[model samples]
Target: MSIKNKVISTLALSGAVLAFSAAVSAQDATPSTMEKTEKVPKRGGHGDKHKMGGRRGMMHGIELSEAQKTQLKAIHEANKPSESAMSEMRELRMAKRAGTLTADQQTRFAAIKAERKSKHAAVKAQIDSILTADQKQQIETRKVEMKQKMQERRELRKQRKANQTETAKPVAG
Candidate 1:
């Protein structure tokens, strides 16, 4: 009933909303098989070995020249961190989820994630540098289109979940 308690509750609700939205819209590190079903020639759709897209896989319909592909692949390989580093990041995430990570571990994990993000950005920038003006437009258009598609999918999933919960109720005797 106090102002302090009301503020705490409001903060908690906002945090939950943000967390749910993030989980719903987070892009995949690797696109699933379903996403890779259709192959677009020249245009890097989903399964790009070169990692042309950023961490969120934004390189949807942007066509890449063979030379550009080679360059992007080289940049991607060079920017990749050690296997141990990635494994440690995974462990840190698990610790956080388990509510067992110490303050020091949280700091360390934040540093690791930031470093990873920077490396990803560097690779993406390298790829973007070689793209022509038209290519850049394609990338931007595809990103917007994909974002809308993702939002639609999330809405459908929520509706389906609600329906299932409703159907699970026992009928009146």
Candidate 2:
């Protein structure tokens, strides 16, 4: 081929290769939106049920007695907030997220969150009181595993963001 024709052909081939590689790399580099959506548990779904089951449920999975189940369920029920307070907290969170909350409202929201967290900790302590040393150890192990998994997830998200930012920059000649 003539020199000019050879250069043109080479450029065309390079462009085609870049496009093909981008298409393939895109598929491998990013997770599908559906996959991301599936990773999030549905509200009031199995996740909620598991959380509601609390330490008792976790122990049950490891084979706690019927009496233990009854005790655990009682603990969970007793610790559950009154419906009105739960509703108010939900409303407050929604309002805050919507950017409709004022400074005073934010203060109240912080107080509510603190109160809920304290109550949750108290309930957890009560549940722990019922657990044997082995069961408590098991729960602690599970908590550590969960923390590790969460850390891994955060790192993955950070890496993904960095990759996205790098890819978005314009390539220089």
Pick by lDDT: which candidate is best?
Answer: 1
Give TM per candidate.
Answer: 0.63, 0.63
Across 1-173, the per-residue lDDT of candidate 1 in tens digits comes to 99999999999999999999899789567788977896557665555444545546655456678897787678867887899998999999999999999999999998988888888788778877988889888878877888899999999999999999999999999
Candidate 1, pairs of clashing residues: none
**Model 1 residue 77 distance off true place after TM-score fit, in angstroms:** 0.9
**TM-score of model 1 relative to the true fold?**
0.63
Residues 27-122 of candidate 2 have per-residue lDDT tens digits of 867778898778675576654446655544445355567776688889988887898988888988899889999888899889988998999899
lDDT of 1 at 159: 100
Segments in model 1 whose C-alpha atoms lie over 4 Å from true places: 1-57
For candidate 2, list the clashing residue pairs, or say none.
Answer: none
